[model samples]
Target: MPWNWTQAEWPNFHYDRAPLERLEQQFLVASGEILGAVRHVSGEDRERLRIDLLSEEAMRTSAIEGEMLDRSSVQSSLRRHFGLGVDIASARPREQGIAEMMVEVYSGFAEPVTDESLCRWHGMLLSHDRGLDMIGAYRRHDEAMQIVSGRIDRQTVHFEAPPSVRVPAEMRAFIDWFNRTTPDGLSPVPALTRAALGHLWFESIHPFEDGNGRIGRALAEKSLAQNIGQPSLIALAYTIERDRRRYYDLLETHQKTLDVTPWILWFGEAVLEAQQVTLARVAFLIAKAKFYDVHRAHLNPRQAKVVERLFRAGPDGFEGGLSAENYIAITGTSRATTTRDLQDLVERGALTRTGERRHTRYRLPI
Candidate 1:
């Protein structure tokens, strides 16, 4: 059931004109100046906090119900990802077996990539305990990647995917083309549009026995990171996940024609939504920082360090239960001093303590 490359059926597409043009302006204004303050994070505790929050945000939306998580889970995943080290190449949600695979991806990276690395990355995404739809379910048999959305009348599709569905020979060639054609080696399209196109192309390829959507989105994310030379502040997929119907329809319409205007509009709108949520997150973080700015004078060095860490890895961040053991590791302070530090912060109305004994965790007071 391989794509004939000659008679593959496609989709027809259209989008409202004025609405997108106006939304595009909103998107520009929304993201404006965000990087200004963010760039101030240079080896300071603030930098540490930004890294923690950014990674936490990225991982949350990568989950099955990633768009939404209760505060506790958000904090927990933050701790898990940061503590274990989730980064660009971390265990992508599609991977399913390895313990600390996310850590591996984060710990390793440099430069934009092409070649067979995508296939390797895609494989790792489906690797141990990441627990995606199809754990390591690459195409071993001659099965085709299919679409099962309601619009298609649940039509059954059958096509041959050779080499590997995740990066079939043809699809891989296209990826190579994309990487090469990027403007002056600086990503051909804006990060936002590139992300959308990455999603569109991969879905069209229908690569992978399972986890196509998840992997495709992840690909978009990585592709975006490459475009910007850093991770983007928003989860475009989260926006798509919010209104999955239009998400599919946009794709369906575009399948018939290659005009990417509607798809670009979809991406632009998603970016704007993502910016809104990210701005809210940053505002909360800034508030937390202001609390510390006012109170930093009363805290000992260790206490200050701990507070900074807490803000950086708020509830959706990576505080690791604020256990004494971790406190000792993070600050190298004595038991009595650490206790006093934690107590001082709590007394100052900066944090709330939960759980007991070895299970204790301290977090920012909402």
Candidate 2:
């Protein structure tokens, strides 16, 4: 019965500065700890962590939109982006496009956010799937927009964006606020706060006909990158996906009120949680580095490839390790050769052997 936050007269939003300031401080401290943990890793591990983190971010962000991407394809695109040569498999066009968008976003972290830049990002996102009927363009004035779900006969309206006529001017103002400084006719706001507010503002605008969710998340990533002075390892989208219902509810409630403190708080908490998860995952990178250091020189090609898969398997690493059949399948080796190789690895202390005869299996010692 009433206007949404954006549609209200003089809807200028504000929040409790004290709480946001505290959250920003906490975020910075958590980021600092992650940086310290990262610095202790070897250069190779650091690079791998960077690639792996971004790959996860890209894949998880797309997953939030209900799109399941092939992890290898996404990783291939990322590998090529870093000049790290593609793996055995090639990336699909859609995967390549998403990878390109992420690389560009991280590369341009220091630049100001602009409408044109946002459009370009949208184009890259939709390039592979041209059937989306729109390409990096704003919505048409005649198209009615609403976030709806459920059966057509039982439709539920979650939110409605501002009319198409207001999009251009709304975006212009948002961008100006984003780029402006403390003395530029605006109050001084912490960079992290700006990042959180920017995310909320962009999503509320819902400027594009499609890809708004992904683009909005990317914009938030941009803010975190610019403010933190590093591309983020925090996969906020992953956290959102894990709690999608609450994420949507937060947006719905905040967009209807002028006070956005709750939304900002929720975002900050989510970021902290994501970074903590990343820190735990960093253990894999560290272990990987150590594993390769001790075994690379001793391992044959087949053994090396098999070791990679075992390590990648994490805690779920095959029950009783990998059998000769699994090893042969992975390395294209003969059953006899696989047996001999596994025996040699055990003798070399590179792997541990369990069971006897055909029931035997091999696993990384480390």
lDDT of 2 by residue, 163-264 (tens): 788888889888888777321325546656776788788887888888889888888887776677777767788788888889889988877776788888
User: Residue 287 in model 2: shift from native, Å?
Assistant: 2.4
Best by TM-score: 2
Output the lDDT of residue 313, model 1: 62
Instruction: Return the lDDT, model 1, position 134.
Output: 47
- What TM-score do all the candidates reach, one by one? 0.58, 0.83
Q: Best-fitting candidate, measured by lDDT?
A: 2
Which lDDT value does model 1 have at 18? 58
Candidate 1 lDDT by residue in tens digits, 34-132: 555555434454545544444454444455433333433333344455563443433323322112233333333223445445455556544544444
Tell me the lDDT of candidate 2.
0.80
List ranges where model 1 is wrong by over 4 Å. Answer: 1-32, 40-60, 64-110, 129-138, 149-167, 295-366
Clash count, one per candidate: 30, 0
lDDT of each: 0.56, 0.80
